[model samples]
Target chain A: MLEEAGLAPNVERKMRLDRLQRQPEVVGEILKEHVERQQQTEGLTLRKLSPGVKAMIWFLRLYVVFMTVVVVVNVVQTVHP
Target chain B: MAVQDVGRENAARALDRTRVDNARKNRKKIWLLWLLIGPGILVMLGENDAPSMLSYSATGSQFGIGFFLPFVLLTFAMAYIAQEITVRLGAVSKTGHAELIYRRFGRFWGNFAMLDLLFTNLLTLVTEFVGVVAGAGYFGIPAGWAVFGAIVLIGVSYTFRRYWTWERVVMILSLSNLVFIPIAIMAHPSWGAIGHSLITFGPLPGGWNSNTIIIMLSDIGATITPWMLFFQQGAVSDKGLSIKDLTHGRIDTALGAFLAAVAAMACIIATAPLYIHHMNASQFGTAQFAQALVPYVGHVGGALFALGILEAGLVAATAIATSSAYAYGEVRRQAHSLNRNFKEAKSFYAVLFAALVVTGGIVAIPHFPLEYVVLIVNVIAVLTMPPAIGFLLLLINDKEVVGEYRNTWFLNVLGIGVGVFVSLAGLLYAMTIIFPNWQL
Candidate 1:
C-alpha cells in the first residue's frame, strides 16, 4: 500500500513511527477511520487553498475602478484643457 | 502484514502532501523577492536619461572634473537613501506610493502630490522626446521620423500583454549605458587627480558662481525626483513582492545605485577632455560633444557619446511612460498589472500610449525652444522632490503599513537628512531661478 501511494519507502517508515509515537491511541483511531472512509469512498483527493487568491481578486477589482476613472478623467481633461 | 502496509501508505501520503505544500510556499517567497528589485534598477537607470547626460556634460564643461564629479556621487547616494524607503513600503503594504499618500494624508495633500507629479511628468516627457530627436539628428534622421518612430516603439511595447517581456526588453536596451564607460576610457583622464578629487573634494576650478550653482542644482535635479518614488513603489506592488523579498529588493536598489553613479561619473570623465582643452561647450549637445571628441580621441569616442545619448533616451522613455501609466492605473484602480492584457488594462495602456504620442508630437513641432524645456523639466523634477521624500519616509515608518518591515531608526535618520538637504537645495534653486544672480 505504501508503494502504491508513491511514498519513499524510508519516509513511509519514518512517518508511521512518528505518528505512532506522538499519539498511539489517536493514530489507531485515525487509521481505522481512514480505512473505513476509504472503503466507502471511490477515491481520495488532496485539498489545498490557493495562496494569493485574495490579493489577486482585490487587485482585479481595484484595477477595474482605477481604469474607469482614468478614462473618464483623461477624456474630460484632454477635452477641457 | 497487509493491514500494516495500508496504514503506512496512508501516513506517507499525508507527509508527501505537507512537503509539497511547503515547497510551493518556498517558491512563492523566492518569486516575490525577485520582483521587488526590478523597479529600483529600472528607475535609477531611467533617471540617467538624455537630459542627465546633458547636465553632466554641462557640469564638465562649466566646472571641469574637480568638484562636480564627486558631487554627482553624493547626490546619487542621497537618491539611493530616498528610494530605499519606497521598497519597504510597497513590499509591506502591497500598494503604490501614490495610493498610500492619498489614503493617509487626506485629499489636500494627495491632490498636491498628484498635481506636482502630473506637471513634472509631462514636462519631463517632453524633454525625453527632445532627447530622441536630438540623438536622431546625429544619425541623419529627421526630427519628424525620429518622433514617429519612437511613438510606434512605445505603442508596440504597450500592445504586449506581459510585464516580464516588457521589462526584459527595456533592461536589455538599457544595458547600452555601458557605452559611456568606454567613452570615459577613451578620454584618458588623470587617474591620480580623479582619485584625489574624490577623497579631498577641493579646488573649485570654476569658483562659486552663477554657472556653478545652476549646474549644481541641475545635477541634483537629475539625480533625485518625484517620478522615481512613483515608479519603484508601483513596480514592487505590481510584482507582488511580500515581506520575505525585502532583502533582495534592498540589494537590487544598492546595485542599481552603484550602476547609475558609475554611468554619471563616466559622462563626467568622457567630457573632461573638452574641459581640459578649454573648449567652450556652452551650447553643445551630445552630437556636438561627440564631434568635438573626434579631434581628441578619434571617431569611435564620438560615436559612443551619440549612441549613449540614444540609449539613454530609449531606456528612460520606457520607464517614464510606464511610471505615468502606473499612476493612472493606481488612481483609477483599473487593471494595473504588467501581467494583464491590453483589454484588461486598456486605460493604463491607453494613457501610456497617449503620453508618448503627445510628447513626441510636441517635440516634432518646428522652432520650439526644446533645450529650455529640457532644462526646466529637470529643474521642476528637483523642485518637486522634497514632498515626495517626506511622504515615502512617513509611509515606511507607519506600523500599520510596513509592520515588521518598517524602516530602522538609522534609515529614518538618513531619510530625514536627505529630505532636509533636498529641501534646502530646492529653495536655493528656486531663489536662483527667481533672482538669477543670487549665487555669490
Candidate 2:
C-alpha cells in the first residue's frame, strides 16, 4: 500500500522473520543490534529556533495589531474631528 | 596509541549508524509530512502576495481598520475553511478542481467557472503589475523597467521543469511579505486605541460611508477569491499529495492562513501612518502611496514597505496566472504539472505566459487608469466567490468523489454559513457599486 503511494514498503516483518527462522543465532543477534541502532537514530529531536527570529515574529504580530488601531483612530479623527 | 585507535574506530562505527538512522528518519518525515504540506502552503501564501497585500493596504487607507481589519481576518478565516475542504478533496480524489467540476456537474457549469477564473485572474494580474510598478516607482525606478525586470524573473523561475524548484522560488519571494511587519513597527502606533476598537466594535470608528463600505468589501474580496480554490487544489494534485499526507496538508493550510493574515495585517499597519495623519493622498497608484510613506516611516522603512508591495504583486501574479493555466489545462485534459517541460504542457504554459504578458503589458502603458483595473479585479473576485464556494461544498460532500473523507456535519454547517455570508457580501457590494447611495 505504501509502495502504491510512492513510498517504501515497511519490510520490518520480513527482516525480523528472516533473522528468526533463516539466519543463524549469532547473525540474528547482530541483525537485531543493527535494527535497534537504526530505530534509535530515527527518533525525533526538538530544536529551538534562534532567539532573534522568535523575537522578530513576536514583534511583527504586535505591530500589526497596534498599527491597525492607529489607522482606525486616524480614520475616525479625519471623519469626526 | 592503541587506546586512541580503538576510540577512533568506535566513533567511525557510531557515525555510520547515525547517518543511516538520519536517512531513515528523513524518509519517514518526507512520506508523512513533506509532500502534502508544500502545495497548500505555497498556494495560500502566494494568494496573500502582491495584490492581496495592496488591497489590505487600501482597506486600511480608505476605511482604516475598524470594520475591515477584523472583517478582513474573518473573511480570510472563511477562506481558510473553504481551502481546507479543497485540501481534503484533492488528496482524496487525486483530481483537479476543474476536472471534478466537469465530471460531476457537467461542462456548462465547469465552463462557467473556467471563464470566471480566467477573466478575474487576468484582470488581477494587471493590478499586480500596477502594484509592482507602484512599488518600483518608490525608489525612482521607472514603471517600464520594474515591469520588464519582474517579467524576466518570473520567466527564469518557470524555466525549470520541476514543481519542487518552482515552489521553493515562489516561497522565498513570498517571504518578503514579512517586510511589512518591520514597517508597521517603525510607524509607532497607539496600542490602546487598537485594543479599544477590538473590544467595542462599535460606532464603526469610520461609520457606514460609501467609501468605507466599498473598501471593506474590496478587502474581503481580495482575501477570498474563486481563483484560490482552483489554484490550491490543482497545486496539491500537481504536487502529488496522497491521503497519508492529509494531516500535514491541513497544518500547512492553517500555517498559511496565519502567515497570510499577518501579512495582510502588516500591510494595513504599515499604511496606517499615512491614513492616521490625515495624509489622505487618495492616490490610485501604489508607488504614490509607498512614496508618501517615506516621510512617515523614514527612508529605510519606506523602502521596505515599497518592496513589500512589489513582492505581493509578483508572487500573486505568478499564482493567479498559474491558476488560469491550471484551469485551462484541466479542462483541455493536457499535461498540467510544473514538473512537465513547457513543450509537454504547451497549452498550459502558453496560457500562463500569455496571461502574464498581456496583463503586465497593459499596466506598462502610460496613464492606463490602472485604478479602474484594480476596482474591477477586486469586484469581480468578490462576485465570483459564492459560486466557487457552492461548488466546493458540493464536490467535497459527494461520496462518489471523496469516499470516507467527505466533510463532517460541522464542516458543512460552517461551509454553508460561509457561502451565505460571501453571497450577501457580494450582493451588497454589487448594490453599493451600482447604487452608491441606495442606503441613504
DockQ score of the complex predicted as candidate 2: 0.02
What tens-digit string does per-residue lDDT give for candidate 1 at B1-440?
A: 12243233233333433333344455765544443346777888888998888899877766666888889899989988988888877666666777777666555567667877877787888888877877778888998998888778866775555565566677667767768888888888888878988888855785776567668878998899898899888887665454555677788788788888899998888888888899999778767877887876678788778878877887888788888888877767676667666776789888888888888788888987776676556766765676677667767766655557778999889998987787676555545445655666
> For each model, chain A TM-score?
0.35, 0.39
| Runs of candidate 1 exceeding 4 Å displacement | A1-81, B1-36, B433-439
Enumerate the candidates' DockQ scores in order.
Answer: 0.03, 0.02
- lDDT scores in order: 0.70, 0.68
Docking class of 1: incorrect
Q: In candidate 1 chain B, what residue range of length 10 has the lowest lDDT sum? A: B1-10
